[model samples]
Target: MYAIPDSRLPLPQVLDRFPAGVPHRRNHVNDYLLVPREVDYFNGFLALLGRAQPPLQTDQLATAARNLNDVAAGDTPSPCIQQRIQHAHLLEQLLQDRDWEPSADISRELKLVVAYLHASRQLIPDTVPGVGHLDLAIVIDTAWPKLAAEVANFVDYQRLRHLEAERQGRSDDAIAFNRSSWLELREIEARLHEHQRRVREGSYAPEPFTYFRVH
Candidate 1:
């Protein structure tokens, strides 16, 4: 990745000093720079830090930041600041992994995921319960097939089951699996397309073929 020069403070410290409210746009020379979304992520990080008695782990921080962005974007009803902060920390850790060098395909894919998460967050409300979490997972799953196994294991299967139940008109359960299943399916389809493209380009080999004979 093109190394943006390191910020003056460590990620946590920078987050600590983050200011409140939306950031302003600044023009430098001919370039119009929107305030770095990272600033929002950092502010959200601090907010999360304040709520949790113990500081969150790096991975948690990143996830919270992404969540906060989603809340801010109106994707969710407005996730609590604490949740946003935890997500942010998780994202930061993922981005900082030394294995994600700019030249590597994985690094590029990671950046694409971050950008997608950022854009998605901007598109929805942050407070919307579970929007950030679900959307973030969708982005990761779409962008990184290698991580699919982990995601599959971690996803809320009960929620999916509940969604299926709701679709069948069962309101008795009272569990609101309000997540957008259609969107998740669309994301999965997009990932499949991307995987196919990679295989066609010889960037990645196709997985072993599995055939099922319909009885």
Candidate 2:
């Protein structure tokens, strides 16, 4: 497991501290979408680590965090609640099934939940009170945690693979190849982060969810 030295450090500072070209990867399909509750859990986990990284990039991470948590806890459910509950159930089932072990990564599982939430936003009608204009902050608030988790997991997996190869006495050439692949993944992650940053800045808008929107 990768060690986080100080969770109190802000996310931007953490990103700045890491080398510019470290590799990262997208999460597996099943674990891509995260529900609001899961987002709260993740942020709390970050707080426990002593670093404060919020999924959304707005200056007010704490407020954003609380708002999402509130949404999850409130009695009147968000329009996407049913879908999220269903997705969560499916995930729980998959996680419980031992036959699915080889295909599972806890990080990926979490990411799929994030992806589902992103997709779920579309389930709300354009006529819905708060969702009509689909704000970028809302999108980022929903998407960033999964993206971050995927990148982190990619790094962790590569590190473990490299160590395993070294222990197995793999040829130096093979090890070099793995390292190169890992570096490429890092580059991909950097691009993803940049892309997400742009999306947050309204440089790009997500494609409309044809199937998700309630007509």
Candidate 3:
């Protein structure tokens, strides 16, 4: 949960896959960071990527996780691994949430990131022992700076939707409220609470002088 500089975020364990001295590691990381700058090229690359390789199959994922059951070897999966998986799903859900529409650039970028996850081959071959899937984390962390706000807003929208459903005496999942209505409700609630707080506190006033004189 601690913050680190973006440049240093690709886990050290993944970088260790390089030999004691090799420029391949540095070049590989740079490609990820820099390629997104050329919008047309990147988009075309993604299109070709989709056509070139089949999506990661369910069996492939199962094979990757089969090692987790080796209790005798004490191979415990990291909680962060599950968190990353959930985060990927969250990004997908955000794109689909009809109430919150994203900017065109954001929509395209999200599709690229999701497509990267679905692709069978990646910058770092998934077959590598320890750092196989770490590249996926690196890609997500790299894109997170641009995506964090939109994701946060989507989360807030979801929270307010559930609250709105409760207020309407409807099931949380059944409510069909939109973001505009939620925003209006939020503003009105905020103003009313502020007014109530001011009323309860009375007007800001100077302290009254004590009538009784001390002997």
Candidate 4:
């Protein structure tokens, strides 16, 4: 398993710092559900996904937890919630891309998170009056570090492939190479550009052989 740093897991931070102040106080039921309770429950759902066996009778609490946590957390002050949710769509696209090979753990995590994003009734249902996507935002924020590198690399691969396709007058899908091939192509292009630069510089002769010039 790839070693993810502890900081990438938001649970610890949420546990340590939340329920401590205005926005996340335990008495503030909406805020409480959105911050720690729902997030904690969602983490449990992720655990369930990793298991091979079907959920046990006792595992039914996850369902109950989801239902109990079904809350309409009123408006979030954070403006980034919409943008963050949109970014989740990008992760969804990355998950769907057959050519990209994320690590097994990452792939599984993405599948589960993306499944939650698509679910009709999430911790805060998408149709809720406000803060519908806040839970998703929290989940994605937690998982972002894990997904960030793969998403960036996939995006770069797509860009280079698209440019190559345009040069060849073909569709992006017509390119038959994968990430490794793209890296090789990028390296070759870099080397070729460096060689061209050296050639250009070599064309310019020094002002003169100073020793040979009259003093």
Best prediction by lDDT:
4
User: What TM-scores do the predictions have?
Assistant: 0.25, 0.23, 0.56, 0.63
If candidate 2 were superposed on the true structure by all CA atoms, what would the RMSD be?
22.9
Tens-digit lDDT track of model 2 for 142-175: 4334444543444454454556568778842365
Give one digit per residue, the lDDT tens place, for model 3 in 62-179.
Answer: 3223332232123322334434555667888877777667656577667777877788646445444433454465456556656766677677677778788888999866877776
Model 1 CA deviation exceeding 4 Å by range: 1-91, 97-103, 147-215
Whole-model lDDT values for every prediction: 0.39, 0.39, 0.53, 0.58
Candidate with the greatest TM-score versus the true structure: 4
Candidates 1 and 2 compared by TM-score, better number: 1
| lDDT of prediction 1 | 0.39
- Model 1, 1-215: lDDT tens digits are 21211221112221223333524232211121223454356335433323222322333334434434543444342334334344333445456533222324355554555555556444223334444343344233234344332223223333353456677777524533323543474467679999999778775555566886778
Better of 3 and 4 by lDDT: 4
Better of 2 and 3 by lDDT: 3
Better of 1 and 4 by TM-score: 4
Off by more than 4 A, model 3: 1-80, 124-132, 196-215
Candidate 4: global Cα-lDDT?
0.58
Clashes of each: 45, 22, 0, 0
